[model samples]
Target: SGGLHGVGASVVNALSEFFLARSWRDGYEWTQEFSRGKPKSGLKKGKPTRTHGTMITFRPDPDVFSKTHFSYKTILAVSESKAFLNKGLKITVENKRDGEKPVTFRYNNGIQDYISRIVQGTTLVNQEPFYFEKEDDFKIECVVHWTIATDTEMHSYANSINTSDGGTHELAMKAGLTKAVRTYAERRNLIPKNIKSISPEDVYEGLYGIISVLVKNPQFQGQTKEKLNNPEINSPIDTAVKNACEAYLLANPTMADAVVKRVLLAAEARLASRAAKETVTRKLSSLKMNLPGKLADCSSNKVEDSELFIVEGDSAGGSAKMARDRKTQAVLALRGKILNVEQVASLEKIQTNNEIKNLLATLGCGVDQHFDLSKLRYGRVILMTDADVDGAHISVLLLTFIYRYMPGLISHGHIFLAMPPLYKIAAGKETFYAMDEMEKEKILAKLNGRKFDVGRFKGLGEMSPDILKETTMSPKTRTLMKVQVVDHKATGKVFERLMGKDPKARFVFIKERAEFAELDI
Candidate 1:
């Protein structure tokens, strides 16, 4: 509603190569046809019909657009959202291009149905969503529920259009919810004595909420409609949300207590995280002369030239250090898998692990909130493990730690996985390496029946310094997969399911995907 104004149909019609419209109204069917924005046929009356809607069919001009394909899933999602926003409204979508089945979206409970779907499988602080709708200057419908998660999820819409870049309405909603929760907690003296105060960040940590407002004339920031810019709608929305939340909390004492406890726990975790960050900063500031003893430091002080190779075992570390260019390449050998930060309860607990401590000290960049990319000692942080299942597991463990603690490394493209060769082939004087079984077979096929010696490396420990350098450590010859986070939410969910404390989640995941798993045996 806020996105395209009233000219969306006209614009689409103008941009289409072929456009056909059929309308059933006033006991008659009317039809019109247009080609390339010009009328091909005048509006013609057809057989009498009792229907009361318009049907438009159009083919996008391939000459005007780079691509003219439509995604059925994307259209269905928008239809579902619209149905959820407007209660009892039914929207149907069908894709004839790909022969997709028709889908009908209708929700009776409006945004409450949306909240139910979001919190379906998660641990909940609120048994049911706290829902309320009010009308003043602008109609506001808000629903909220609290989960046991450490992260917050909130969706705000203006005039049925998603406001992803939240504007005045979102800000007001947050303020109102924060005020309500804080007031309730303070009234009941639910806050712990150890906790000084709670911030909005704490109260909304695990909150899942949907705020939908119907504005007569919504002022959007841009053509995208990602944000609502109307400042006048703030006060009404704020008051409505505050009053609704306050009333709900007052009526549901048990839910209120649960919410308060959840908020306090979040506050405590926030405080501990701040303290851990401070501790790391203090240590990093003081420990310039005391890099980890296991780290084979490079001669180059230039961050752009320096590399840190996190090798799997001491043997591999030794070989990497021996083969490395001492001016730019440094190696730090981890004994085995490091602590899984996803399973850990707190950042303080992560700091206590010996392997993690050594890593934090070696990197120079502070952990968590105190992380500074400018202070990093290395341009590249490579994970060089064996080319096997065990090595992949170890790499995953290390990645989990890095993802939870120093995500900046992955985000900034400083993290990489070194591709070590698993098989070594010698055809007379020429030597070649293969990373996997498929690669080895391909290489053998290319050899054309020539007699050759094939050796399978059990681990990186088995590789000589020269071989290891040639395959993995050398920048010019080696293949490195740069670790990146394309989708933060999806990646985080994967880590949670795999490395989290919930064994049941991991079990279910493994069971579902066991058929596709490749056995190292």
Candidate 2:
């Protein structure tokens, strides 16, 4: 179903070797079959049904793809998103391959429901979202709400197609919201006269918004059609969103004031952080640039071709460096666990920590407002820790650091957690490795009748250089669990509940996820 323009049906038909389609309409039912996009049979009559609809079944050609596996999650995401964008449309997605659990999605409330679903965990300034629509040369509609969450999330669509690289419409929406909120704050005398004017980043810090537009003859910037190039619709969209948001705020003073306070607080924090960064910058012993002395830097300079392994301890670091591909793989050894970034109060304090400083500098991206993903030195930033509870804690601490300050690294699929073998089994000259208890059991069963010895790896340092290279350091053979953001808001909430200062929240979170936990001696 992923195709360009109206080619969805034809594209699916062309790629599928065996295709079947049925249509029930006009007091008659018709069916057809195709083999490789060619008609195997013409219109065949079928028994009449109560409803009129079309159903299609397809199996993509095996030759077209090296692997034929499909992602149920991807299918479900498309169905759910479509159901939300098209009000009153019912979409039922089923995974027939895996016990076929069907989920029905019908969003009569449209983007309002989507907004509510996205902000379920966050504290909202307004319980009910503000929705607006306008029709003229272009049909524009949007829904917006502010959350207690720090990051601003914006989703944009043109003709129901997601525009990940937002263009003029998104810019217009931001400008409108910022201007309206700033004006309201000023009129209410919420800001002290000494404070500088509010910034767009401040007003948008906690914004959760979606902008959907129906356009005619859309001009796109690239092959992906990620951004809209048409400039004519910007003014109209800006006017519509601004007027609607302004009107809603005037009608609800409490909500408006609360929103203003949230933005003002964000602005204050930004200023404080910037001032602290300046101080920290001055405090550095030297401005001379160099990789951390402990880091075994890779020869490759291209970001896409390089990987950095943040190993747990000096022993593991030495092993990883010896096993690593010197051409592209770099290793940095941390003494112990990184500082809990959530508990750290100031940017200067974070900068002062040697290990944290090395990480920031090695990435070639500063934390907070100074972070530039384009200047990042590594394509993959992997956490190569031991397979233990402490290792897990270290990973969480590192994740917290990235999520809090340089979130772009995670969202862009650059962060990963390395998977090292947990056990090594040798049967005479034949040696086998296992990643988990299940894998170990399988390997033991495979060498059932033969004499074998089992060796459990307590840490990466325990593995010989050759074994480490084969199991964890080699890009071709290593198993790396990518750290990605599937649901930004949900992920943020989980991070807050697990790593923030709220012990009660953390306990509740642990309890919820521990339902399937089993105690091990």
Candidate 3:
């Protein structure tokens, strides 16, 4: 399969302000230069050389691009993917801007090496990855490995180009693998009698696979080459992969049994998760008029006009309730530190926690996979905590829970953090609110030695109802930071290191960034 219809190089040259092309062939070096698609210099012979290769370098035209900078990580990932797709191919990437060391990516065993790298520390159901390659009218190569993880990770390629949206090839792969696993399990009587059947999702729960196909002419959905559109290749690829997987499973009974057992476990979890979700849904449905007992609900029934503030304690909750607009704003005061959802083993376990259940009920949006954005009760969910280290910790914990379960809250611009003042300064009867020490100092500096009184707030509970309404609760004067997820992969790693069960991970993380940390103590 080919991409860009042979216009890739020409397009790059056209978009580049400065372009240089060098070629070594016929025992001589030839060079050419171009600027904005127009030739600056004709092809010229430099010197006789033994090497025979082409090299092109170009700088993106600043006028054509708003931002001309390239991300090193993205480039490295694309380079590594190319190396993995073509076995024994070596790709080197160098970043001169940061003086970072150049890195080389080479995978001798191709996708098998990819699976090995991905599952390096992960527990595996299959010790060895199953690999098959067919070089014919359409070259097809695939590798699959099963792990103890709960999700599937698969990469599909069409002619070495990444196909992120998938299409016929990916569909074929899933069907083939599911068929192979189901047949093997049935033949060996590995599946339990009580369990009805194993689904495709069950078979792929812990599976990691890579599928690469090279067709003479491939049909892509768009210019991005995100999906394959060919219908004829599906049946042949499915049959080939199914036969290959069947033979491998028959040859290795131990691995086959392990795979089947993992699938069965996933199937069981699916049933249990479904039941748990149903129970939660039924219970929540019965509580239309019975919102959380502690919640002080707003008078308005219109979702868009309403807001909910999740306060830290009863003291703060009381202050917020007294300060809020009765028609638009509601308050829910959590008694203590809510459950640390990162440590919870399952969704069912999370549902069992009283505080979490109350919080979920208050939101009116179901948790986890059952979450519905349309069912959300409030237009905005504001976390109004104290301006201190403990408050920050509580906010992080709450964010972890929301990110894991109701990600739509953050992604859809519904989640926000209330920026309450830490210090209130009165200079000659003119009052000023400061969010932190820096703001307080700036305020003092501007006072210019005038007689003033500075009051430091211990927490939101310490602030008066009138002051809270004026500075923190009123939409006209208050500052709220919208929660957003910029890089979800990095965010997940941070959450795992800080809130995950392993204390050592937190220690290591703190140690690594200790120099940059500003300890309040």
* Candidate 2 TM-score over all chains jointly: 0.75
Candidate 1 C-alpha error for residue 264, in Å:
1.3
Report model 3's TM-score to 2 decimal places. Answer: 0.62
Please provide, for model 2 over 222-311, each residue's C-alpha lDDT reduced to its tens digit, 9 standing for 90 to 100.
655668888998887877788888998899998888888889889888887888777756754254266788899999978899999998
Question: What shift in Å separates residue 463 of candidate 3 from its native position after superposition?
Answer: 25
What is each predicted model's overall lDDT from 0 to 1? 0.86, 0.83, 0.88
Q: Could you tell me every candidate's TM-score relative to the true structure?
A: 0.58, 0.75, 0.62
Return the candidate ranking by lDDT, descending.
3, 1, 2
Candidate 1, residues 104-187: lDDT per residue as tens digits?
989998898888876777899989778888887778888888999876677889989988667888889888888899999999
In terms of lDDT, the poorest run of 10 residues in model 2 is 280-289
In terms of TM-score, the best-performing candidate is: 2
lDDT of 2 at 290: 69
lDDT of model 2, residue 393: 84
Ranking by TM-score: 2, 3, 1
